[model samples]
Target: MHALIEFPSPFPEEPGVVRLLEPPGSDIEALRARLRDGSYGRPFVLENGGLRALHFSLGYVQSVMKISDPCALQLGYAQRMTAFLLFNPRPRQMVMIGLGGGSLANFCHRHLPGTRLAIVEIDADVIALREQFCVPPDDERLQVIHGDGADFVRDHPGRIDVLMIDAFGPDGVAEELASFEFYERARGRLSASGVLVMNVAGNKETYARHVERLLTAFDDAVIAMSVREDGNYILFAFRDASFAPRWKFMRAIAIELQKRLRLDFPGFAQQLERGQALRLAQRLSA
Candidate 1:
């Protein structure tokens, strides 16, 4: 049977749906086990099929990873890049570890206008599924490299302006993506002015630990809040360890930045500030 559920958030219009489809007598945990093995659910598309995104539901996890217009996720990544890297007007090259629905790659291709974008995806099936997700053809500025993200970044000796790690396994968070060595490789590939951004899912402390690993390699770390509660968080690390934004300026920037991206800016900034405050408060309380 099919069950539909909705998530309430500031951005109610975002495309997301949860389904519980299991045969009679099947326990939710049993079904979740199946999903953990990566063999459940069918392909999903929007009403018009205009957006390139996919979601598989197997009666497990609180909610399915509904990449509402994966292209939007891609554009969102580019917007984050705009906020951190491109805005500075430095020469730019972007390396994305996970192609997902190829939204970010396509976004960089169309918008950045002059940025070099390379996407490394481990799944060939996922790569074949790109056309369904609206990924365009190969071009001089855009290249799709099929390999492990860590391997690609490690093997390459050249510098990159921005590196985005959004890798997720069939079950959940990919363990290898979180290792200290991976951050070391990412740090090595970055130019002195480069920034590293990772899409991680979990609570604030869980997110902080992930950022902390990068902190070992890099001097500074900043987190960009997600639009929705209990969703993925973006962690950005910079080469120089001392990057700090003035609270007043950050608030203003978040206000102006809200209009530039797909998320609710006010909420995004507020949550980020709150998380930062909690992090600081805890440090002092200790």
Candidate 2:
């Protein structure tokens, strides 16, 4: 671990100065060369008191983890991803697109022991930092693949119970990962009752475009919850149109999951319901 250095934030309104710590001899020139070659951007660690965060660039915080409890999820969207359990409480197999700091992967590996996890991350540098993020090693139940998420989904159809799309580059979500055809391929990879969850980070236009693509792919069997903290949207699209939203039953499941996983699952479910209602009203008015 590198010594923590007090790093000033470019944003004046930001709460506190970040403390960055980078590994020694991590060649900046080499990373730049890789970036030029269309490889992943360099990743660094930031700390603010006890809170530790991972970033590929100063513009975005990829993942956050509590240094004391590395396994615990510290981001709102990450906890919201657990809402996937509401759709399939006990999924046989889960496929994750991105492995940024392995927040979702680590939590699911620890909490959902019975479920098998396969994470697809394009960046090898990000994967190399798995130890720093406390990512679990691959076993029979957990496997991390260094590859393109879109290609993985295209090759494996109808094999995933829960498919999560969180792949992103420094600028935003990867272009290929966010396209309409990619979503269609993702939909084709879902089982009969599978659920696809995606974490989208961008402006209103970008969010709308991604949601529209999901709606088109799933035939409007999609709902979304917004993370007020970072303006990130968590989208859920179901393979089965019959999987209706029953707030009462979902609330019950949320309560149960909260007790088991120690997360605000009920709160997340409520947010999803609220977002769904707001979107429905917008559609009706339009």
Top TM-score model: 2
Query: How does each model score on lDDT?
Result: 0.59, 0.80
Which residue window of length 10 is worst by lDDT in model 1? 3-12
Off by over 4 Å in 1: 1-52, 56-91, 202-211, 224-230, 246-274
lDDT of 1 by residue, 32-72 (tens): 45444546544332222243334443222211122454445
- Candidate 2, residues 120-154, lDDT tens digits: the string is 99987778778778888889999999999888888
lDDT agreement of model 1 with the native: 0.59
TM-score of each: 0.67, 0.85
For every model shown, the clashing-pair count is: 4, 0
